[model samples]
Target chain A: MKKQLQSLKRIGFTVGMTAALAASSLAQAEDKLKVGLMLPATGTFAALGTAITNGFKQYVAESGGKLGGREIEYFVVDDESDPAKATENANKLVKRDHVDVLVGTVHSGVALAMAKVAKESNTLFIVPNAGADELTGPLCSPNIFRTSFTNWQPGYAMGQVAAAKKAKNVVTLTWKYAAGLQSVDGFKEAFEKAGGKVVKEMTLPFPNVEFQAYLTEIASIKPDAVYVFFAGAGATKFVKDYVAAGLNKTIPLYAPGFLTDGTLEAMGDAGQGLLTTLHYADGIKNAKNDAFRLNYAKTYKSQPDVYAVQGYDAAQLLAAGLKAVNGDFSKRAEMVKAMEAAKIDSPRGAFTLSKAHNPVQDFYLRKSEGRDNKVLEISAKALADPARGCKM
Target chain B: MDFYSFLIQVLNSVQYGLLLFLVASGLTLVFGIMGIINLAHGAFYMVGAYMAFALSSLTGNLFTAILLGIPLSLVFGAFLEWALFSHLYKRDHLEQVLLTYGLILIFEELRSLLVDDEVHGVAIPDVFSASIALNDTLSYPVYRLVISAVCIVLAIGLYFLIQRTRLGMMIRAGSHDRDMVQSLGININLIYRTVFALGVTLAAFAGMLAAPISSVFPGMGGGVLIISFVIVVIGGIGSVWGALFAALLVGFADTFGKVLLPDFAGAIVYVLMAAVLLWRPEGIFKKG
Candidate 1:
């Protein structure tokens, strides 16, 4: 009887300890916010990914590594800018890591895959860089949001700039792909409406840098201006080749900011005076932008571009939502409502989200000067995506 | 298109074709004489382009960069052969493919570590930077013409070296019967090593010459590699002459296809490859 009583006392002690541990762990879980970052850590888009990650972390750091009284825990996965692996990589973060929110991706194709997974799982997702229109148009969810402009935004703004320049006949060139085609479509929609003609729409296979044939044809067509959509290494090569072929001297080149952003340094004198449109530029003289740029350069040893701006705004949007709920994820409806209504004071300037969850922001006319896309003027004010296929 | 535009397109085709030849010739020579399918040949081209970018930045002249880069590439090629590829010779094709493919990954990773993945421009030598005006708006960069001239010169020199020299005789003989050449007291291994290094040097030199126009970037080799393989296969694998012919044919097809059928341009070269394969299973030339 004495031994039996001792065994019961031991069992009671174990039960009490287990209850205490469980209660503490539950409290800890509620106090932490899990953020999954699925970005390209390798391949062509790696540098852009790094800049975005830096910008996100920079904001969190400024807030003392906490958002809305909750400590932030980050899980990172490199999507490799490959769409084939994007679903699996996102699932690793969502299903396995059980992250509360997902932030990602520069490549449009990979972004689409991540959006599908996020939609299916009903996880909160914020796109920082990819400008795929479908993300906000057809595939948008109440849980999904974008801090960056749609692919159409900058392209449409540039078309207005080109038409205002009185370019009667314009040629559009890009690699044949969804991003390229959509950008061209955006350019056509705005330019043609403004009484300009797209004389030719030329495209090569995706990732093909050989532009001699196309350039030769462009010269023959003799359009008043040439608008192109190319980014990264392809952009640098095109700018240099365009200058080398003497087309830049006779026929001016117009493009969205992607043609000049992150590519000006490699373009040398070839990129001088090249005009493009974007949501952010180096010469935006606002106090918030100044502080953000100063802090980003000091912390990362690189100047923040539009991509970094988008990432920073993504964090700001999330912080606003989290602040509304005091880190209570169970109050998700109220939190999401707070996010939709919040005006993000971004480095690009103050912007609000459209009904489709895409940023309604200003697009700036920027010129490539040395290593900077110096802001010339505001090209468009508070531009919003049409969200053509969005039902919600 | 008008006559002048067509004339310019022809010039573009030829220039592109000649550049492709410089890269494809090396592939053919390595395969013909060594019986080794070098998947990493394109990586050597990338190395050359990067060297041009680095050396030109240091020296401030692309001509000087190429002058310095050639010997460095020769040494690199020789060292790589002696260290890793020499062992690969006795292995089967699968083993060779695996090893060379691994080399490509290693080279790309090393490039990323050494020089971050950013596009870099190599300035054309000042003398070759000017454009030759063909019409009011159409002008051709002189650097491209210079590239065609240099490639033609190299091709002639390569022909003389392989067809007219004693070393060339030993190389051709060794390719045919390695054991017989060894029995005849010739250092067949040395011949193979020299041939391999020469092939590497040619590819690297082409890369250096093209860098000013192409702009050096990562994965640049991947595109060139596929085309080089096509050239080698279409040119009858081992024949340098055949590679030259195939490269030009592909260049014309690609250039014109882009002009005529913009939507189908990417498929045109592969279609040409298929047609050629159907016509001549051994390629345009028999294995030498």
Candidate 2:
């Protein structure tokens, strides 16, 4: 017992010393262009952030560790997918290290908070994964650019798909948050615009584990199709429960992209044939996408998702912006102009700036399937473009 | 509510309550009987989940993983009891809390190092993947029913072990007067070890079961740990049956609260705990 206490004490001392030394060393490196990547590095969203970081790092590596001929330095902080932590990390990046740009925020709620800090500091905020509509809508700012789709675009496209399939009655199940509600609202707008009735709209909270009761209610509604917007374990549990409710035979179930990959991995065979929409898919057969997929698979030993692809694009966009400015990053106006005029080729396709300063790219329809007892994308192809209902 | 909806809610409540019992039983025994306030009970739960995740992945069998995990958890609990908890048994609540509070950091950091920070999940068996039909329209996965049944059996076994057995009487007596049992020439240290091991095993078992339902990520146990403390408080400290009753009550309230009032569901549990404490300072059930 005495030996154990002594060992614990020694471990604590070593850890404390190591942390102190790392902090001091970090303080001395001042000339480099520091970019802070803030996301959930240690929580339920860790894998998502990790993949995004991998994408960011891949771009850096491919660029010979230099962006616009300047050696780049990256600082990644774990936000734990908490809004308060996002705000804290953003402040640290903006005020402490004085990072050249901030690229991150996976949760919509956290992204919204970080947007406020970006507005205050006038730093380039390149959001890659968070799908809150307000990031490019009402919350749109001169310094902010979203490389990912909003909660609206995918849901609206889903509505169009439902309309084409001639699904009359629809039931929408979403997490009761900004991102979740926006997803349902987007689908509702697109579906109703195409003359369809929304039978039920269920708003569940984030991190909800069980869905048996809600499934019972939705099954009773007997809608033609069920549109869901859940992420993480919630998505996995929902898919399992959807199958348990036997809704797949009675009513078709559809969701956005995030519901399929990590969630599907968790759900395993239960998630087979689950359809979702996105801008990028691992199964896309394009030259650029295939190359990116091959490179990502070779490097990470896992297929890259849209979030990772967007994060890579974000790094590339920053590089393009820096190049456009003739590498003169001292002037915000010059950099902003360069960023605005920049066009880049993405895994999705060639993306250019919209009036809102967000990306205008193609969307894909994907279905989850198991090939040879391992989960893989079965169907993936461009289906729609982000347009209408936004004058920004 | 419709019959199908009502039945599902009942199932949700039962499953949740059973999970709470698993954590609270360990906690209440340590606190009520031993008079030690442990904030690190949740950390053990976290350890259990991560252990199950790693072991199950390695062995490719849940039963083997559980067999290995429970002993590891017991050893961990015993180590904690010897290195930290036993020292504070004679000390006041403040010191016990401060020491156990430090244990939380130790446990969390250790778990983080051992298990990479990722939002992964434990896979359920193939047979349990399908739902059992309660009726024509209402059905749930067989895994959940299995979880409920396992919890109930464990709860019954624990009740019998603690109440009916000779060892149970000694533990009950030790809870009240540790030195008195020591004076009677009983190996009080061995008794302490047994009780501590039993407490931790319950928490780890809960973690193993819950791993499939939720994302088995870092810091996952913190949330459940706090709720279990609430269960221990609401049920009455050191009372195993009280822990069981309170676990179910809290579970039902939390599940139904979420469905009926989504916003206040989490807040309502703490509110109920405070209200119950106000009504009966010790808890809903007193230690007999």
Residue pairs in candidate 1 whose N, alpha carbon or C atoms collide under 3 angstroms: none
Instruction: List, residue by residue over B65-150, the lDDT tens digit for candidate 1.
Output: 99999999889989989998899877899998998899899999999999988888888888888899887887889989988998
Expressed as tens digits, the lDDT of each residue in B161-217 for candidate 2 is: 889999998999898888899999998888887888778777787888877776576
**Alpha-carbon interface RMSD for all candidates, in angstroms:** 1.1, 3.0
Give the runs in model 2 whose Cα sits over 4 Å from its true position. Answer: A1-34, A75-80, A297-303, A371-392, B92-112, B119-123, B126-130
Candidate 1 is scored at a TM of 0.96
Candidate 1 - chain A - TM? 0.93
Q: For candidate 2, what is the DockQ-based docking class? A: acceptable
State the DockQ of every prediction. 0.66, 0.28
In model 2, state the lDDT of residue A296: 90
Any runs in candidate 1 off by more than 4 Å, and if so which? Answer: A1-30
Instruction: Name the lDDT of candidate 1.
Output: 0.91
* Cα TM-score per model: 0.96, 0.86
